[model samples]
Target: MIAAGTASMGRAATPGPSRWPRAIVRLRLALRSSEAAARGGGGGRWAACFRPAPVAGAAAAAVKEAKGERSAEVEVEPARGGGEDVWSARADAEVAQGGGFPEHLVVMVNGLVGSADDWKFAAEQFVRRMPDKVIVHRSQCNSATQTFDGVDLMGERLANEVLSVVKQRSGVKKISFVAHSLGGLVARYAIGRLYEPNNRRASSAGKSRDDVEHLEGLIAGLEPMNFITFASPHLGSSGNKQARFLLLFYEHMTFKSLPFLCGLPFLERRASETAHLIVGRTGKHLFLTDNDDGRRPLLLRMVDDSGDLQFRSALRSFKRRVAYANANFDHMVGWRTSSIRRQHELPKHRLLVRDEKYPHIVYVEKEVTNNRDTEARADLYDPEEEMIRGLTQVPWERVDVSFQKSTQRLVAHNTIQVKSYWLNSDGADVINHMMDHFIV
Candidate 1:
């Protein structure tokens, strides 16, 4: 049944190449025009390139067939007040059935150069699967060239965007974040700024330990649930090394991968140095080259709570924290960085087996806590090692994904998140695995 379902999904999801070329051409033209407008100091022109369209619901179609009925129609609340474009996925069936709207808010964030449209498919899947359980909001505050701003500034915008959403959704009592790639880092920073201690719990002392724990902190004044990231560079991307030229050459020879990273070590070194010029401050942050105010890189400082930002504390408050990493063929992010592990800690090849239910998920590691003493500071120079040490202070569930055998392997970074249904439909299994294991 699982195998059949997989095949059916793949067939339904992958769009024919001949059918999408025109759309691609139009999109490219729109982006070029938007780029020109951006250069002319009009940032808002980029919005036209990402107008919300009906999400291609390949996974939702299968879900509807299984349930013997259509899921609730999703409603979109477009961008307003010059804020982020929000794809609000509300289940319409609940309203028809006289049910109150869902109180759990799921915020979906896009990666660098991406818009809220990037998360449309996943947002639709989430709403369709559990129409009454969640309200998925795809955030668009820092899309396009705006992502060129440093992580700190992007994070501030995200935090404010979230707050505005919460204000509008008065019934939402719980919150979760699902972010992709560089957006994961932005979400992490935003969470720190959004965290507020639950002072009401202090006044009520008779609560059980579990109750007290659950009420320990609030993110944007709502209980924090799951914090999940796909192919996120948690440990930064600079120092982490891949197999180099052999893999780079192989990817170029066979599949289309990111052009910025297709050379030898010297090129890799050069890319690290000049990344900021291409992608702006985000590139610096990803490469761990950002040093604002002569302090350590923002990622290193984020490992521990520095002053009011409570980065680590906000992270620990979540009920579950998950990092989904691509095991290979993800030229954009290295496995060591995404999974937040040391060089030797990566899973051995022998352990990677395809689960019948989740074909692409190769290995799952239970939460592991760092045993390093809290008093000890990480090595100052080795930021990657320092980040690993700092982030592992709290336990994290690591999920390793591999598209090595699939045609989509070359774009494993985007495939891991199923960024586009037509191009990365094979990753539907990965998205299914995430939703099936998602903590409500």
Candidate 2:
């Protein structure tokens, strides 16, 4: 998932396509190999690779390895019984989900730098709120895949996974989504490639845009209902926090893309123009130090050049495909990029239902009464002050189910585990709303 990083939306020539392509290829390869090493017994040196794009059923395919040393062929047990090679084809098990769900099949996509396990708590809440409905999880590339290019295989993979999930779920005829951060971008790219129309007949020479798009459309015909993105930076940054060098490169480079990035096409000059349009007040968060045994750098600050326009381009390509939206805050993504700008085209959609605020859990953590006073504080808030006194309070932001679509943004950067007593909390409520939209 794209959080705070630097990628602009404009197009620029990669300088004669000479050394740049080779360099990109080399960089991409190194990123892939190093990331794999980092993931596989390397002691977690890098952040987890971005989640793989979606697939329908068969394990999604990758761009044929540049190195003859191919990746281990991935095999997936399709929920559906079909044995087709196409990733989007449904399996028998997935078809079963169509039975009689109280809610629709809402596939949950987790945030950047996380996995399906990350949404386990939220899924539990959904199940509790409406047990009769089917709640699905989109297994991203991060769950099993380990490569910088895993995203290269995601869009088609996800396109099919949605079909299989709904087909096997018994009563579900269509699928909906609840996504966070880069997961949303991945989903959009997958959906667009799968659903976008292209009738022109192109040669099998190379992976041309129209050709790639057509292939994507063939898979995306499996349209699901109401796509949602949480705290996803759809608009890219305006370059407020970045130092001068990166901004300068962004202006001159018009960087349409990086070889490592998956999906969206990176145009150079267009990217520069887009960077100039940001509203630039990103959220602030307590840096998550020790998040990965101290190997992970603290990423609490949101400076300029901290976002990519590739995701924004991907989102823009199929903005129409998304029906509703939500956001989580202080987690990494900013509020400005997650908006719909109150779409002038779609009367039925206002883009997002944004609920920005402090999460209640951080305030109500277990308190220490006899601490020797280790850390310093600028000014303590309610829950922090309460914690110092060994007291707790109900986290208020934990009150809402995360997927509510009534507003344009949701600002809870801190998420608390909701009690799952057969679905009584906000997670459950959000799931219920999804059910009403899809399964009903």
Candidate 1, pairs of clashing residues: none
- Report the CA-based lDDT of candidate 2 relative to the real structure: 0.33
Q: Model 1, range 226-305, lDDT digits (tens) per residue?
A: 99999888887677653131122222222323222233465466656666655567667777778889988888899989
Best by TM-score: 1
TM-score of 1: 0.76
User: For model 2, how does the per-residue alpha-carbon lDDT over 1-440 read when each residue is reduced to its tens digit?
Assistant: 21223322232333365635454454344445544653564423221222222344332222121112223331123245221111112222334666333335556664433455445444533444344444455455433222112232444566566656545644443445566554554565455444433342123212355534523222223223456554444433222121121122221123211222211234222233332222111111111111334332112111111132122222222212332223332223333334322122112224323333422211111111232333556674322222222210111011122332212112132121211211112332343333343332
Instruction: Output the lDDT of residue 70, model 1.
Output: 35
lDDT of 1 at 184: 93
Index of the highest-lDDT prediction: 1
- Provide the lowest-lDDT 10-residue window in model 2: 391-400
